[model samples]
Structure formats: C-alpha cells, structure tokens
Target: MFDIPQLDLKGKVSDAEWQTRVDLAACYRLVAMHGWDDLIYTHISARIPDSEHLLINAFGLAFDEITASNLVKIDFQGNIIDENCPFEINPAGFTIHSAIHEVRHDAMCVLHLHTNETIAVASLEQGLLPLSQYAMFALASMSYHEYEGLAVNPAEKLRLQQDLGMKNFMLLRNHGGLTVGKTIGDAFMHMYDLTRACQIQLQIQGSGQPAVLVDQEIVDGIRAQANIVHTGLTGGQKSWPAMLRKVYRTDPHFAR
Candidate 1:
C-alpha cells in the first residue's frame, strides 16, 4: 500500500484541516483495532473544518492502512476536491456519507459499520431492543431506515435524509448501524456504544429467555441527560485523548 511515498499534507492544508485528517485517520485505526472494520469496505467520514467538503478513506485502503495524507477530499457531490490526491472515493460509500452530511449540520463525523453483531441485530424482526444500558444509550438518539438495497441510487439520498431526520444514531434495516457526531471522537464513541449494545442484545437473545426491557421512564430520563451532556461537551472529548494515545501506541502511522 505504501509503494508510492504518500504526500505529507501537514503544512499544505490549514491547521484545522490537518487536525481533522489526523483525528479521522486515528478513527479508522481505532475501528480496525476494535475488529469492527469490514475489510476494505465500510467508511467513516469527517466534514472538513469550516468547509462544505469532507475527508474519507480512499476506496482501496484498509482501515489500518489509512493515513492522514492518504485520505481524499471530496465535495458532497462526490467530486474530488484535491487535485493531488492519489485515491478514489467509493461511490456507494460517498452516497451514504454525503446523504447525511448534506442535511445534518450538527454531524461533523459520520460512521457506518457492518459487524456480525450489528448485522445480527439489524436482521432481527425488532431492531435494537432496549435490553441493556448500552442499548438504552443508542436508543436515546436512534432511528431506523428500511434497507433499500445498496444505497447507490441517487433517489435513495432523499429517503436516507428523511429517515435520519434529527437523530444521531441509525439502524439500516437488514444492513448495519450508523452514528453521527459533532466530532470524529463523538462519532466513534457512539458507534462503540451502539456496537456494545448490539453485542449484549445478541447474547441475551441467544440464551432462549425473554429479555427484560428497561423501563420507558428511565429511558426517557437517560435520553434527556444525553442531550444535555452532548450539548455541553463533544461526546468523546474526555476519552478521545486516551483513545488517540492508544491508537498511536498500537501504530503511529495513521497520523502520518
């Protein structure tokens, strides 16, 4: 993957953009570290700081192989914005991300994944049950979008935006899970929580006993608290530094 010497874009772009690239790259590494990556598929995108464009992993790069300089910059319409970028963005992946970024001004980063547990939950008749605290956390801001095949059709964009509405978490029926955040860390943290929730749900469901659902009142209270907390601070600020440290310790190349 490193056959060509990747450009060092640290000083070429604005500091804000560079930092966004670093965080987004770190996010990809973190996803791979957690074993949630779907090989070279799936995508995580971050809106360029103060711009209409976004940075996404190049179409062929594995999550662990992504680097700050290797990410591609593209407009919402999938046009490559950086003339020197050496990679192509996947059209289907761009469709999913651009659909969200176009309307969700609050969503600075959008993450989507298709893990065994997440897919297991999505394929169920009732998606993402409120069976655990982790589930409750995701349910607080979650919405569901009925699967519409591969999401490549241009018409699906409007439907995706409409289904997403104002929610920060989404379950793409028969597909997988999605999360949005005001920062890359926030988005990653949401996906982590949602994935944990799905894991717990699958375990409980496998035990052959009916699940004990959380109380609706308590769920409502937690949702309210989440809104307050996220409004006060970005979702992962307190933990993101440690997360980046962990990523660097594992492999510092993502920040390159």
Candidate 2:
C-alpha cells in the first residue's frame, strides 16, 4: 500500500541518460512480470552508455514500482552521483553489481535474481545440467561462483571476478543466478533462458526418471550456430522491440 515518492527528471538529464533510465526501468518491470522479483531485494544495474555512471533501483522500491525517473545514478564506488537523490543504494547490491561492472567493461547491464527455481538449481552440487536445449544455451556461457556469505565484503570481488571470467551467465552457488549483457535486453533474455532451464531441470528431477542429456558435440555445434547468427548485443536487439511492446501493453508507467 506504500506509494513511491514523486521523482521527475524529465528535462534535467541528457537524452542518452534518459533512454538508459527508461530501458533499465522497463527491465525491472519485465522481471516483475516474469515473477522473478524477490520483493525489493534483488538488483539490476545498467551502464549509462559512454559514462561511468550506472543506474540502479533505490533499495526500497519494488521492481514494478521502479520508473525511469526514480532510478538512482551512482558511480563505480557506490557513491550517489546525483546530489538530489534521496534514496540510498543497497550495500550488498552495490558490492555484487559494481564488482561486475568494474571489470566487465563490455557489459552494459548486470541482472541478479533470487527466484525459487534458480536458487534450487544453484543449490545443487552438480550445478545446471544440459537436460534440455534451454539448458544447453545457458551452459554455453555459464560459470559458477562459490557463495561467500553476504557478498558485502570488498575482498570477495577478486574471487567473484575470477570465477565469472568472460561468461555472461553465472550461477552463484547456494545463492542465485546472474546474467550480464552488452544490453539490458540481452541480460534479461539470459536470465529468462537460465530460469527456464532451471524450471525444466526441477520438473525433470521431480519425475524420478532418468533424463537424457544432449550430446556435447551437438551442443557445441548449436552454440556455434547461435553465435554466428547472433553477434554481441544484436542478439538482444532482435527481441528487444517485441519485449518493449509487451511491457507497454502490460503497463506504460514503467517508462514514466
């Protein structure tokens, strides 16, 4: 029943920054629509194109409540860049998101979620298996980061960066899932494919029957073909327009 405070920066920011805000806000709304939101706990950070400043949701706002005008702009060290911004960034979210953004220069967006199915899969000792095509897609660029308590400590950044390497998808062991993209849409789609793969894995495991795993050679071939067709951020751009249309139909206020 809480109402978010009014935030209007329509004429204050540059055109590129405003568009980044809108896209990042739309990403939050899409995450909520997909039922991946964990109240106000999770975080999604997007870079401001050519700037070092990044956009993140205020710690207390629900994903659906996030609007373009409401996201806080912060620097790499988690300092609020906008003096007028009232809300503080989440400390833990900062430690996690900023670490990736600090080194992953090519990544424009970093999405971390704690959905039930994704957590379940992350808790598995064997990690995600390629039981389906969705799983294969995830396995293509996925890596695993061993969980280290609250992730608020700065020391954990080194290990996290090493574990993540150049992978786009990361399974935070005993924690949750992570996806980094050259664009917001790419990050969202990465999480979507990972979430689906986790759901399918859970369903298959629940059936108590032996599952057929895809051949590694075939999996590698398909991954190569996918790379050939979808290069860099182009993969996300292909479906981003449709995603924006879906978000607008669901609720246009996210872009406000």
Which numbered prediction scores highest in lDDT against the true structure? Answer: 2
Whole-model lDDT per candidate? 0.90, 0.91
State model 2's lDDT: 0.91
Residue-wise lDDT of candidate 2 within 90-158, one digit each (tens)? 999999999999999999999999999889999999999989888887898889999889989999998
RMSD per candidate (Å) reads 1.7, 1.5
**C-alpha lDDT of candidate 1 relative to the true structure:** 0.90
- lDDT digits (tens) for residues 29-48 of candidate 1: 99999999998999999998
Q: Please give the lDDT score at residue 74 for candidate 1.
A: 95
TM-score of 1: 0.95
